[model samples]
Target: MGGFEDREKAFEAKYARDEEVAFRVTARRNRLLGQWAAAQMKLTPEETEAYAKSVVQADFEEAGDEDVVRKLVGDLTAAGIAIDESTVRVAIEEMAAEARRQFMEAK
Candidate 1:
């Protein structure tokens, strides 16, 4: 764990090959996101998983709408990926506005 990049590479390799470790890590990440979102919403950590799951699923499966963005940002505290919620929000909002404009123009 102390070897920095080497450790991270090792962990990634393990994650690629070890289902158990992957699952444990995934659950831990979810727990982290849940805790973060729960704090934002003033809820308990125990009460956060459902929300986190919903948010995570929406981000992956939905149309990338405001709800998806809101939920994603609200709960994405433990994400290893470096993304800023404000940037995501702005991008989504721009897309939504452009979609609306195009739809209206076509009518």
Candidate 2:
């Protein structure tokens, strides 16, 4: 019983840590994606930073990546950039990998 409880506790801790890491990775990916979009739109340096932060905040609007995708697609199109959902999806994957790599490097 004691060992069982210990295992359960450890599992919970690991779950929490994993969730935190995933959230961080997602946020980082969003920031990178935002910067990429901003670059495509030829935004100023300060505008790029603000846009990146806005993208990160956009993620909190809903679960999954739809919110971010919608925001990016809408904003990019509005800026006269030719982008589509598929391209944004690919960027998300790329940014996610980069984000994970950054985290791993940090550790």
Candidate 3:
């Protein structure tokens, strides 16, 4: 019983850590995606930083990535940048990879 309890606690701890890492990676990806979009829209440096933060916040609007995608697509279109959902999706994938790489390098 003690061995089983210890194993369960260890698993729980690993799960918590993994969840934290995933959240951080997603936030980093969102920030990178925002920077990319800001560059596409030719935003100023200050504006770009703010936009990246906003993008990170956008993730909290829902459980999945749709909220972020919708925001980016709508904002980019409103800014007169020709972009589509698929393009943004690709950017998200690329940013996710970059974010993961960054975390790995930091490790």
- Per-model CA lDDT versus the true structure: 0.55, 0.96, 0.98
Q: Rank the candidates by lDDT, best first.
A: 3, 2, 1
| Candidate 3 global TM-score | 0.99
lDDT, candidate 3, at 22? 98
Task: Return whichever of 1 and 2 wins on lDDT.
Answer: 2
Quote each prediction's TM-score: 0.35, 0.98, 0.99
Better of 1 and 2 by TM-score: 2
Model 3 over residues 60-99: C-alpha lDDT tens digits? 9999999999999999999998899999999999999999
Residue 83 lDDT in model 1? Answer: 52
Worst 10 residues of 3 by lDDT: 98-107
lDDT of 1: 0.55
lDDT of 2 at 97: 99
The weakest ten consecutive residues by lDDT in model 2 span 22-31
- Comparing 2 with 3 on TM-score, the higher-scoring candidate is 3
